[model samples]
Target: MVGLYMVPPDNAVVLSVDEKTQMQALDRTQPLLPMRPGQIARRTHDYTRHGTASLYAAFDVATGKVLGSVTQQHRGADFVRFLEKIDRTLPRRRALHLVLDNSSTHKTPEVTAWLAAHPRFTLHFTPTSASWLNAVEGWFAQLERRAVRRGSFTSVSDLRSELRRFIAAHNKYAAKPFVWTQPADVILDSVARASRAMRINSAGH
Candidate 1:
């Protein structure tokens, strides 16, 4: 809920947690043309795909600090490991309240047991097709624009290293906290319109 995102800073620590999966290592066919005065930067449309990597992250809503982990596969086990990493990184006294989407992995038996064991952790799930409520997605957009989009990597390992470096730099320097500006009613209206359009399209077919 929007209220969870808007919770007071002094309250429980709110984290927007999610996984950015299958990020590709794409090398442009030709070198990119760097930007100058009047012209914009450009790159070849075609690319060579080395492989893909998955990133699990928890973005602190109040502090703008991120706890991240990279994985070769996106699985419930990996998600649990990331949760354990979060549990270790954050201060033991501060309770964590996570905003997540309706991903099945988030509710697996492993994750449920972990949450049951850790009373300090709470979860707030966004409605279907409404993950934009999670602040982590905004952080992800920054990663895409600043690193992954125009990046050139030869292998999945190289890409993973660069991703880790980016995460480190982000916590050190780019603590740009994202504010939730849209009202819940506005978002619900948008989703309603989209659902209607999809229903109309499906009925026509």
Candidate 2:
């Protein structure tokens, strides 16, 4: 099944996988401040330390759905765990095409061997340093803006709970396909211009 997100209705699933790191588990029991005039607000500079965890997230581009797991490590094994979760997200019969970056964990021999064995699942790597090409990166940015940045959790479990809550809340009413605002020709033209400029500069040396 190809043209997963663009053609047909749910014939295929496009899963974008990635990992976010160094999430500190901070505990702040108090409620966040509401916007008000002359409100200096309050924040805990030093929160109770409950260790940290790396979030391995998978987003379904077509459905606006997300599946995530938090662990202390972001390695191949952890990525495999996220893959298992992705499997659980979609039904057994449908095919899944994964879009991901070429992180070391993603290209380990074990992962390659696993993919080799599972012909039904295909992995597509985004261009190097072009993670923005992955739809899930946008979802991650939303997660950071809403549930992660400047947010505090009392413990690892609390962090997990908050993420679960955020996902649940999001699934309740959030679903939109990303529109391609820029045409392919426009992008190609921009790239060609940059390449021409680079070549001219190099010839001067």
Candidate 3:
């Protein structure tokens, strides 16, 4: 993953893709307290659940810009639609190399068929339990912290609107290429040591 981020294919776009599933549209039970000079903002503990939304997002490694969609269902068909959106946005001449996790939706027959039809797209799956290797996860964390967390939404539509606004703001103000500073060998060595330790502990048990 580090190697791919550091040295991506020429004339190809590298994207880290993932989904933020089951995001609740929660409305606070009571009005939130406004922050003053000496007090911080506070919200009620209880909330009314309006509905849920699934966010399918793709982060371009070369440019911190993100392409995303909100869906009611997270089925393979929805994923295909997201991929199609990405396909339409990119230039036909440039290939798309996507780093993704081993999610069933990504590997479903529908998605695989679409990929087969679009030879310009290449899928690269990170190792199991290593989703952190995908740069998109970091972006997701930022989104949750900045946009979703501590937010009060009256309905699913409100939540979706806020998400879209956040993405647009990020693209306009904060978009920049993510650089991987850690060397590939250093990451590999650490993974190797952890694997050896796990094996030794298993043998002992």
On TM-score, the leading prediction is 3
As a whole number from 0 to 100, the lDDT of residue 66 in candidate 3 is 96
lDDT of candidate 2 over 102-172, digit per residue (tens): 78999888788777876668888765545566777787788787887668887888887777787778777
Answer with 1 or 2, whichever has the higher lDDT: 1
Q: Write one digit per residue (lDDT tens) for candidate 1, span 77-157.
A: 999899899889888988888889879989999989988999988888876656667889989999999899979999999
The C-alpha stretches of model 2 lying farther than 4 A from their native spots are 1-10, 29-34, 37-44, 187-205
Q: Give the TM-score of candidate 1.
A: 0.85
User: What residue runs in model 1 are displaced by over 4 Å at the alpha carbon?
Assistant: 9-11, 34-39, 182-205
lDDT at 70, model 3: 92
Kindly list the per-residue Cα lDDT of model 3 for residues 6-48, writing each as its tens digit: 8898999999999999988999888777888988678778999
Better of 1 and 3 by lDDT: 3
Residue 25 of model 1 has an lDDT of: 95
| Candidate 3 clashing pairs, residues 3+ apart or interchain | none
